[model samples]
Target chain A: MSRVRICRVGESQFAAALLPREAAMPEGLSTRSGRRDAARFAVYRNNVGVGLTRALERRYPVTLRLVGEDFFRAMAREYVALAPPTSPVMLAYGSQFPEFVENFPPAAGIAYLADVARLEDAMASAFHAADEACLAMDALMAIPPDQLGDVRLTAHPAARLVSSPHPVGTIYARHGQDAVSPVTHWCAETVLVTRPHIRCEMQVLPVEEAGFAAALFSDEALGPAAEQAASRGGFDFGRALLRLVSAGAFSAAVNSAEKEARHA
Target chain B: MSIAFSKRGPRLGFFEVHAENYMGEGGLPHHQLRSIAERYPLSLHGVGLSIGGEGDLDRDHLKRLRRLVERYRPASFSEHLAWSTHESAFFNDLLPLPYTPETLERVARHVAEAQDILGVRMLLENPSTYLVFEESTIDEIDFLAAVSNRTGCGLLLDVNNVVVSSINHRLDPFAYVDRFPLDKVGEIHLAGYDEVTDEAGERLLIDAHASEILPDVFDLYRHTLRRFGPLPTLIEWDNDVPEFPLLFAEAERVTAALQEAWRLQPEAAARRSAA
Candidate 1:
C-alpha cells in the first residue's frame, strides 16, 4: 500500500492547475478520503467556472438571452474549460471567447452566436480600454491637409470597429427584458463601439465608412485606406468622413503642418 | 457618485466594496458602485495586498490600492492576515502564513506603512486555512494580537472563519474566542461554509460562503457575541447570492441577535448588583 498525500500549500497549491500527487495511490480508504478532498475541490472548480461564465453572461447578455439561460450556461461551461482565466485580472480575461465561440462545435448550429459574443467582447474591451478624449468635429476641421498623412490618426483606446456576417446591429437594438437581442436577418453588418461617455454605445456603420476606419485604425495611410474603400466600388469617401466624425472616433486630428510628425 | 434622491437624503449604513473590479473605469459596474458610494460610507476591502509574504509586499498592488482609496475616500479600509503572493506567483486565494516572529514583523510593518500612507486606520481579517505548516511558532490569534499591538491597527474578527479554522486544526473555537484580544476587534464577518470529510474520517469544512450559516457556527458566534459585543457585522454571500432581500434578511438576523445581546446587558447588571 502506497502512502500518499495531496501536496500542501508550500509543496503545491491545489488552487493551481498541477497534476495531483495522489495519482499513484492505491484505490480504497485513501480513495474515499480523496473523494472528500475532491468534493471540496469541486466547490472551488465550480465557483471559478460559474464566476467566469457569469462574467461572460454580463458581457454578452444579448447572446445569453438569445440562447436562453440553460443553453447559455451549458455553452459557457464549455467555453470556460477551454479558456479558464489566464490572468487573475478578469478584465484581461475572455479576449479569446469570441473566437472560441466561433470555432466551438456546439456553437456551429447557431452561426450567429459567435458574432453576438464578438460584439459583446468588443464592448467589454472598449469599456476597459485606456481612457482618452474623443476628438470633436471642430478638432478635425482644425487640422491642415499637409499633415493629414504625416499625422498618423490615433483612435480612441476604447473604440472597437467590428465587421460581422450577422445583423448584430438589429439584434442588439431589440434588447429589452429578454437577455438576447431578437434574431433577425443575417446581413453582413459593420458596427463601431465607442465610449463617448461612461456608458458604451454601438452604432452600425455603412460598409464604405467601416473600411476607411478599419484601415486607418490599423495604421494604414489615408491614401491607401481611401483607395481600398474606393476599390470596394461605389464607396463614398465624403459620406464616410461625415459618419466617422459623427461617431466620435478621432482623438485629435493633427495635420502635417509640420509635414512629418506622426500623430499617435 | 449619485446622492440618494430620497427626501431623507441618505441612509447612514456603512459598507465595503472590492477594489480590483473598479480599478479601471468606463464600465457600468464602476458607475453603479460610485452611485452607492454617494449614499453610504464605503470601505476598500483589499484582496491582493499579500502583506504576510516573506518578501516585501508587492509595491504595484499597494500603489493601485492607494490610487483607489485616494479616489473613493472610503470611510474605512482593510485586508486579510494571509498572503496572496509568494515566490513571484500570485495565488488568487488568501494562503496562510506561518505564525512566526518573522511573519508577524513583516505584516505589522506593512499595516503601519499602509495606514501612514493612507492617513487612516485599517483592520486585518483572520484567514480560515486548511493545512497547518510545520514552520509556525505561534497560534493565529496571538499573532493577530501581536500585529495589532505592534502596528496600532484594528482587527476584523471573522467569526465563521474562527470556527472553520478551529475545526480544521482540532482546537476548541471558544478557546480562540476567549484568547482573542477583544479591545482591538473593530468589525465582524458572518458567512457560510461547506463541509467535507478528511482522510482521517473527520469532517472538514471549507469557507465557501455559498450555503446558509450552520447552527454550530451560530453557536460559536454566540460566544463571540458574549466576548466582543456588537460590532458592525456584515453578512457576505458573494457566491450564489439568492437575491437582495435574502441578503438583507441575513443581516437583519445578525443585527437582531446583536440587539438581543445588548437588551440582556442591563438585566445581567441587575443580577450582578443583587448578588
Candidate 2:
C-alpha cells in the first residue's frame, strides 16, 4: 500500500483558496453546476468571515453596541482577515480584538472603546475558564500570623482582573443592559470577573483594592500584599478581603513553608 | 433538556451542545454543563475533531474529548465526517472530503481510534458540501454507510444537510433520503440554511443555520421522520439564535411532525422500535 501512491488533496492549496484571491484561485474547484468561478470563493470566505465576526460580537457585545453595528462589523472583518483563528473554538477567538481596536485608525476617537472590549473579552474568557474550588477563609486563617507574610494566594481559574485608565467597566455595564450611551467621565476603574457559584459575576474595584488584588495576582504574599494595599492609602484590608472572599476570587492558598521550599 | 431563555427552562427531549464549547479548562462551561447533565440526557456533538483529513487524528483533541466523556458520560457523542484541520492549521469550517478507497480506510481508522479512546461508540454526521471533488469515487450515502460498517459507530443523519447537499449536487432530495441507511442512525438534526446562486445562475444552498427553518427543510424533515422513525431530534440554531419563544416554537413544530408521522404510519414506528 505504501508503494502505490494515493491521490491526495493539497491542504495548503485548498486553504489558500478560502483566503481572498490575492493572485488567482487555487486550481481544480468545481460545483455541480459547472466550472470554477470567482463567486464560489466568496462562499468559503463568507463562511469564515461571518462565523468569526459573530463569535467576536458574542464575546464583545458592549464594544459592538458602543461602536455601532456598521463600524463594529467593519473592524471585526479586518481583524478576522489579519488574525484568523488558529484554534477552532470560538471562546478563545477574539483575544487579539481589543488590541486590534486600540491601534485601529478609525477607532482613535473612542479611546475607551478598547478598554471596554478588554473587559468583555475577559468576562467571556472567565465564563469558559476551568473551574477550581475556591480557597476558604478558614484555610487562610489556619496559617500562623507570623508566617502569613509568606503565604501567596492563587487566583481562581475563572478570576480575571482588568484595570484601565478610563471608566471602562461603568461604560460596559451601562451599554450591556441597554443601548443608552453613558456620559464619558474619564476615571480609572478596575473590574474583577469571577464565577463565584455557577454564574459569572463582574464587580468594579476601587483603586486601592485593585492594587491589592494586582499584588496578590502577581504572587505577593498576604502580608506584603496587604502592605502594598495599605500603601495605596484608604484601602481597608479587612473590608476588601471580605469582599474578595465573598466573590470567590482566590482558588488556593500557598503557605509560607511551601513558598520558602519552592524558592529554596 | 432545557436551554432556558426565560426564568424557567424549556422542556426538550435531550440537550445537545457543541463539544468544542466545553473544552475550556474548568469554568462556567463546566458548571452549567454539569448542572444540565444532572437534569437531562446530553449529546456531545463535536465540530473540531476532523476525522476525515489525510493526516492522522489529533491525539490532543481525542484526549480532551475522552476527559469530557468521562466527566459527563453523555448519552451520545458525535462528529462530522468532514475535515477541519489541514497540515497543522485548523480551518474552522467543515471542508469537504473526497470519498475513495484510501479516504475510506483513513476515516474508518480515525473513527475506530476515537471510539477506542472515548470508551464508547461515536456517530459520524454527513456534511453539506458546496462543491464536488473530481477524484471522488463513491456517493455520500455509500461513504457514510461504509465508514459506519467498518468501525462499529453509528450515524447522525442531519436532514437539513441532506436537503442542502442534494440541491447543490442536483440530486433528488427524496431519493437521497430513501437510499440512506436509516437503521444505523442514532440521532437526527434539523437546521436552517441560506440559498444563493452560482455564477451559472444555479441555486446553491449553504447550511448557514442563521434563520428559521424554511418550509422546504421542514417538509424534508417530515419525510425523514416517516422513513427513519421519530429519532432523537435536535433543532440546531447556531447563528443569530432567535428569542426563546421562537426557538421553542421550532421544537413544537418538530413534535407536531413526529406526532403526524406516527398517526400516518404506525408500522414504521414499530420498525424503529425493533431496530
Candidate 3:
C-alpha cells in the first residue's frame, strides 16, 4: 500500500509530490470520482517533467544531441528531480546543468560533455545578457599615452570566456548541422562569447590570448595584463587586444590615477 | 522565427512575452525586444512571481522584473493567479490555489507588493487546473474579484482557461464568465487546449496552447466580449509555434470574432435595456 501524507492547503508537500516520483501523494487529493487519484496526479507530474525537460532541451541543444534524445531525456528527468529551477526565467534555468553533467554517474564516459554544456550555457547567457555600449577606439586613443598603463578595462555584459580541457566549441558547432565533419585532433580550448552584433558570436582562442583576456576581465591594468600575456609565451599582445576590441568586447576603460586624482 | 510586422497582413496588435525569457544581462533577446518595442507595443506577462505561493515573494526576481519593466515599458503587465514557486523551488507548472480567506489575503498582499515595486498595475490571469481543492471556501470568480478589488489589480480573462477548467470540473463555462468581474478585465486571451479523458473515462481539457483556438473557445471569447465589450485581446500560442502566416491566420480569426461582436453590440445593449 502507498503511504498517505496529508498536506496543508498551501504547502510544499503537495507541490513536491507533483514533481518527484518518490514523494507520496498528499492525502485528500481527490477528483470528483474518487479520493487519492493517482492518474490525475500523473498529468501534473507530466506537466512539470515535460515542461522542464523541454526547457533544458532548448537551452542545451548541443548537449542534447550529443547524448542522444532518449539519454538526454532520462538525464534531464534526473536533473529536474534533483535541482528544479529556482527562478521563473527559463533562460537562466540550466546554469547548474553543466555541473550536473559533470557529476552524473551515467555520463562518466563523455568527459568533454560537461565543458561543452558549460560553453552552450554561457553562449545562451550571452545571447540574452544585457546590452552595453562598446568601448570606442577613439575614446581609448584620446587618453594620454603615458597614462595608458593605469587604465582598467571592463568587458561588455554580453562578453564571456570559457576555458575547457576539450575542444568543446568545435564539437558544439558541428553536432547540429546537416553534415558534421570529424575533428582532426582534440586539445584544450578556450572560447570567447560576445554579442557585438544582434546575434551572439563565439570564437576559439589560443591559451595565451584567453589568459590575457581573463586578466583584462578581472580589471587588470593594461600594462600588467600585457605582461601576463607575454609570460604565457608566443602571444602577440597587440593582435589579441585588437581582435577583442574590434569584436566590441570591452565596454569601458578608466584610468585609475585620473579617477583617484579627480576624487582627491 | 522572426517576422517583420507588415501593414498589408492581418491586424497584429502587440507581442506578449514571459518576462523571465528576457532577463539576461544583454544580448540577442534584448536586441530583438528593443527593436520590436520601437515599432510595436509589448506586454510583459510574468510567470515567476508566484503571487499565490505560501512563501514570501522572491526579492531578486522582483528586482529583475522591475529592471525589465523599466527597460521595455510594456503596455500591459500580467501574471497568473496560481503559484509556481515555493521556498527555493520553482515548479515549471502554474500550480493551483485554494480560494480561502487566508489564501485570498496572502495573494492580494503579494500582488500589491509586486505592483508597488514594479510601479505598474498588474493583471492577474485565471488558471486552468486539473483538480479542485476541497478546503476552498470561496468560488474562483469571487476569489479573483476579491483579489482585484483588494490589490487594485486588473483581470486578464483567459477564455480558453475558462473552457478548460469548467470542462475538467464539470462546471458551466458561460456561467463562470457571467460571474467573473468583467468590469475589472483589462485584457483578454484566447488559446487552444487539448482534450483528454481521465482515469474514470471522464473528459478533461488541458490548456496546451499548442494549436489554433478551438471553435468552442472562440465562442466563449465571443460571449465574454458580448458581456464586457472588447478589451485589448491577445492570442497566446506558447508551444508548437506555427509559422508566422499560420499564427497570423489564427489571429485574423480573432479579428473576425471581434468584428462580429462589434456588429452585435447594439442588439446586446437593446436586449439588456429591455430586460
Candidate 4:
C-alpha cells in the first residue's frame, strides 16, 4: 500500500483506540516478541489520557479543588474522550470544557460549578491575551471636562469580563486553600480579569457597575453607557469609570468627534 | 523555567521550551522567553507539529511556528519523529509510526515543507516506542538518516530514547548509537524513563521524563558522546519537576559526562571544531 493509504489505515485504527478506554488492541502492532501485547499498547493510551487530563488539571485547578482529585480526574477523562483537542496549541484546548461541565449530569448538583469553570477559563484567556499599554489615568484626565462624555474607550487586549449569576468570584478567589470559608451570601457576581502588568488581576465588579462595565467593554461611548447605567439607580458612573481605568481595563481613549473627523 | 534560568539557579549552556506552550500571541510566556533569549541561546522544541503524521501538515500550525521563530530566532529548532495529531484531534502524545518507504517519503515532504516555511534547518529526534509495526520495512536509524539526507535537516540524537527503544525492542543501545548518523546530530536530549512489564512479563520502558536520568540511560549517553563527541545536551524533567537546584544538579551530571567525553576524545573534539 502507498504510505498515505498505510498511514490512513494504521493511524485511523490507532487514533480510534486511544480515546476509548476499552478499545481493543490496535491491529498490526507488536512487541519485540511479535505478540500483540495489550499492556504495550496501553502505554500509549495511558499517555494520551494522562497527558490531556494533566493539561486540564493545570488549566482548571479551582475546578479540581472543588470536585477533589479523583472526581476531577474521572470527569476530565470523560471530557477528553468526548472533546479531544481540535487544535495543537494546548493553551486553548479546553475552551469548550466549561459548557461541557454545564451539561454534565454528575456535576449538575453543584449549580455554580459551570460558572466557576467559565471564570477560570476567562482567567486563563486573560493571562495569555496579547500585551498592550493600558490607558494611563493622566491620559483620561487630560480630556477636557466638556468633551469627556464623548470619549470612547477601548478594552485592553488582556481584559476579560466574566459575569455569572453565582458568586463565582468568591469561589475563584478561594483557590489554593485547603479549607474555603462558606459563601453565606449567594449572589450574582461579575469578575474583570486583566493582565495589567505581569500578574493577572481579578476584581469582582459591584452589581451596579456590571452593566456599565459591560457596555464599555462592548465599545459604547461613555455618555450613552453612563446614561443607561444611571437609569438603574446607584450606578456611580464616575466611581465605576475611575475604578476600571485604575485597574487598567481600557487601552486607548478616542473622542467621538475626533473619530468622526477621521472617518470624514 | 524562566525563573530557574533567570533567578539564582546555576547558569547552563542553553534552555529549551515546547513551542506549543508559547504559541500565545503575548503574555508571561513570551515575556519570560524574551528575557531568557536575551541572556542565553534558546532551543525551540515542538511537540505538536506531528511531522510523522500520515496526513498533510497543518499550515496554520506551521504559520504559528514560523511566527515564533521569527520573533525569537532560536539557535536550534527540533521536533519528535512521532506523530501527535490525526484528522483534527491532537492527542498531545508522541505516538509511534511504522518505518516504511512510503512513510519516509511523506515525512521527507513534510520536513521539507516545514523547513521551507520555517526558513530554518530543523532537527528530527528519535522516538521511544513501546510497540513495533508489522509494515516497517526500514530500520529506525536508516530511516532517520534517509530523512536527514533528503531534507538537509539535522538529527537530535536523544540518548534516553536510544536506551528506551533499544531495550524495548531487545536491541543493543551501543549498536544503535554506532549506526546513527552522528555527523548530522545538532543537539542531544537526556531524559529518565519509567519501567513496566508487558503482557508476556517482558520489561518495557516508557519515556517518562518524570524522574532523574537512569544509570543505564546515562551509560548510553556517555557511549554516544564517546562516539559522536560532546554536543549540546538538555536535561528534560517535565513531570514531577524538582526544584531548580535539583534540575541543575542533573545538568551538572551531564556536564561532568561531557567533560569526560571531551577529555577522552580529543581527536573527536578537533574533528567537530574543524567541521
DockQ of each: 0.20, 0.44, 0.58, 0.66
What lDDT does each candidate get?
A: 0.70, 0.83, 0.84, 0.91
Docking quality category of candidate 3 according to DockQ thresholds: medium
Q: Where does candidate 2 stray beyond 4 Å?
A: A1-9, A21-24, A105-110, A136-150, A179-184, A257-264, B1-11, B263-267
lDDT of 3 by residue, B53-147 (tens): 99999999999999999988999999998888878888878888878899999999999999999999999999998887767778888999999
- In candidate 3, position B108 carries an lDDT of 95
Docking class of 4: medium
lDDT of 2 by residue, B151-223 (tens): 9899998889988989988899899889999789998889999998988898888898888888888888888
* Docking level for model 1: incorrect
Worst 10 residues of 1 chain A by lDDT: A24-33
Q: After superposition, how far is residue B106 of candidate 2 from its true place, in Å?
A: 2.0
Q: Record all residue pairs in model 1 with backbone atoms less than 3 Å apart, i.e. clashing.
A: A65-A179, A65-A180, A147-A255, A147-A256, A152-A263, A256-A259
What fraction of the correct interface contacts does each predicted structure contain?
A: 0.15, 0.54, 0.67, 0.86
What ordering of candidates by lDDT runs from best to worst? 4, 3, 2, 1
> Which candidate tops lDDT?
4
Residue-wise C-alpha lDDT for candidate 4, range A111-171, written one tens digit per residue: 9999999988988888899989989889988888878888989999889899999999998
Q: Interface RMSD for each candidate model?
A: 6.2, 2.9, 2.1, 2.4
RMSD of 2: 4.5
Candidate 2: pairs in clash:
A129-B27, A130-B25, A130-B26, A130-B27, A131-B26, A131-B27
Q: How many backbone collisions does model 4 have?
A: 0
lDDT digits (tens) for residues A116-233 of candidate 3:
9999898888887666788877888888988987899888888888989899888987886978889777988988888887788888887779888888888899889888788777
TM-score of each: 0.74, 0.88, 0.90, 0.96
